[model samples]
Every structure is written in structure tokens, then in C-alpha cells.
Target: MLESFSNININLKFTIENEKNNSISFLDITIKSQNNCFQAGIYRKPTSTDNIVPHDSCHPQVHKTAAIRYFANRTVTYPLDVISKEKEQKWSEGLIQTTNTIGNLLKPKHNNKNDPYKQSGVYQLICPKCDMIYTGQTGRTLNERLKEHFNDFKHIYRKSKYSTQLLGNKHPIGQINEIMDVVYVGNKGSHLNTMEKFYIYKETTKGNQINDKNTVPTNKLFDVVILQ
Candidate 1:
């Protein structure tokens, strides 16, 4: 208590208000300014009955009504970007909740209006020309996984194996514009190989071209890697 008081450079005093029933208690503080001869009074509730003014015989008006009116009329503002982000955060949280509640069958919800990629999950890319599909999984984000495909689409010699095999065939649909649509298959996982294999099997059974032959890679690291 002494340490807290010593940290402050201003002259101040504190008083505690005991709670009644389930209502919460609060502190009433009084401060004296050294810089100017300005006096201020602030409280959550009036500490004394004299602070309240009796106008009507039945009820009384508030004593510090002018201070309340002044603060009420004060202009308040927030950044437009901050407001946009707050709204986006709420939308994302709702999507996360809805995704978790539903099993594998729920269609992929777009993270944004223009983007089909999600923050995390197993996703499938469908061919525009044929009914062929490529299923893949990522522990990171679907955006990161889709980026690898986009990289393959851009390069002549593709770095992503699945991207090359899926897009490099005779009935090739190499461009992102040519691709039909992207859909989330299973939930994101650390070891997504099993889920990817299951979706691949399902799609292959439905007559879709299977690009990946190897389900489990040799000496594969299964841990979810987070990059700082």
C-alpha cells in the first residue's frame, strides 16, 4: 500500500465503499493539484445525502448534474480501421464457432468476400475442365497451402509436387482463374496426412484424378510448426 502511494507524485487520498448485497464495492478518491489551484470531485455514487438536491417532494435531483452533462456532451471518437478490425474479429470468431460445431460436411466459409482460403484446414481444389480434384491439408493456414499452388501456377517448373501433377496433365487448368472452386474437406490438424488420405480416397472413388501417391512421407515431421 505504501509502495503504491510512493509511486504517485500527486497529493491524493482514498476511501473504500462497502458493497451492499450482490452489488460491487468501489473506491472514492480525493486529489489536490500542485500545478494549479483547480479543485475536482469525482465519484461513482454520491457519498453523502447532501450531495443530492431535493427538487420534488417525492424525489430528489442529482447535485453534480452540471459535471455529468458536461462529460456527456464531450466528443468521443475511434479510428475507422480499429472499428473495421473489431467487426472482422467478431465475424471470424463466429465462423470458428460454427465450423467447430458442424462435422466434416459443412462447406468452407470464405475468410473474406474475395478470398476462398481459410485461416486453417484441409482443402480441395476442383478442376474447371473435368471433375478431377486435388485434396491437400495444412497445419498452418489454408491461405499458406493455397499460396504454394499459386506459386506452382506461376512457375513453369513447379516446386509443389501435387500442384504440378494436378495442373500439368493433358486437360490442364493451370491458372487460378481456370480453377472451378476451393472447398474445405476436414478440420486442420498437426498430422493432416490421414485426413488428406481419407479425402483423396473419397474423391478418387467419386472418379476424381488423384495426384498424391504417398500418404505418409518417409521420416516425416508431424508436429505443427509455428514461425515467428
Candidate 2:
């Protein structure tokens, strides 16, 4: 099956394996064979960590709420049966999870949002009028970095490549939501830098990114995650 799928697309590679114990996992979800039918639910691998980002981690609100949004969206969007619906509802309601040793629910802790580590990450900013996009990374809050771009555009400053070009082209000024998308979040490190470059390469191949080609070279590894 792997060879067959690999041959279907010369540029792509495929891997196949058999499901075991009537259950199999795929992309954060698990599928189970039940009475000649299939049921799906959230899945977490044994190595998964229950730890979460610190409240004052400086991660954007989007990043903080991503998991909740995903769970809520899945609960509402997936065509789950009655029993699955109950299970999902209970899980989504926070009825479960968050216990220490005695199975008693523990209160979550919070930190002062002012003093914090910079939540570095890769992000994309788009030109509303021309649909052009820029891929970049920063060791700061995404909002902070994006605000600089907006300011540069407002003042016609040469501080940023993307903002200067957007203004020079006489493009319409847009709100942050109109142009920015947070792609990945991490600390200031090589991983964050690599992800930024990878996204730039991805957009460049699509002929949309305004940023220059990144130092990260082309690799076949991305094919595993990318859709054919």
C-alpha cells in the first residue's frame, strides 16, 4: 500500500501500517472500531504532557486559546453519536481533568502578565489590498512585532521591508486582524528561526510571500506533512 501510494505521486512519499487492538490514532484523533462501525475521539500519546504554557508566558491570546477552540469546535462540528456527544460535552465543560493526587480538582495558577519571557514565534502578515504576504519571526509577542509593522506603514518609515513595500504600493491600511496570522510559537531559538524560514519557503513556492528566499534549504521532509 505504501509503494502504491508513493507511485501515485512521484514527488511524494507514503507510509502505511495496520491498525491494532481495534483502535488507531491519526493527527490528535483516535478511531475505534465498534460493532462494525467506527467512532472517533481526541487522542493523546503516552509521551504527551499535560503541562501548559504559563499564564504570563507572553504568548498571544490566540495561542493561549487554540486548544480550547479546537476542542469546542470539534465538539460542535463533528457528527458524534449520542454517547459520544455526552462524553465530549463533559470533557469540554471541564468536568474532568485538572486533579492532583486525591482526584480532587486543583485550581489553576496564574502569573503577572507584565513580567514574562518573550513568546517568540513565526508569523505571517498579509497586504490587504494586494494579497501579498510576509513571513517572519520574532522573540517578542506577535502583537508587539506586528504593531511595529503597522507603525512603519503609518509613518512611511523604512524600518520594515513588508510595511515599506505595502505603503509604497499605495495599498489600503488594514487592521491587524485583516493581515496577521500567528503560525508557530516557541522560545527564542534555532527552532523558531527554522520554522519562520520554512513558512517563508512555503509561501515563496506559492508565489505570494514578499520576503526573500530563506536560508533553510528545500527538503523532502515537509512532504510528509503537506497535502499532495
**lDDT of each structure?**
0.47, 0.68
- By summed lDDT, which 10 consecutive residues of candidate 2 come out lowest? 101-110
Across residues 128-173, which tens digit of lDDT does each residue of candidate 1 receive?
5565677766666666776777677667557665556655764555
- TM-score of each predicted structure versus truth: 0.37, 0.46
Q: After superposition, how far is residue 108 of candidate 2 from its true place, in Å?
A: 26
- Pairs that collide, model 1: none
List where candidate 2 sits over 4 angstroms from the true fold: 1-119, 214-216
Which RMSD does model 2 reach against the true structure? Answer: 17.4
Residues 87-206 of candidate 2: C-alpha lDDT, one tens digit per residue: 877876652243332111111122345322234567788888888888888888877887888788888885887887687888876776677766666667875665766677777677
TM-score of 2: 0.46
Q: Provide the clashing-pair count of each candidate structure.
A: 0, 0
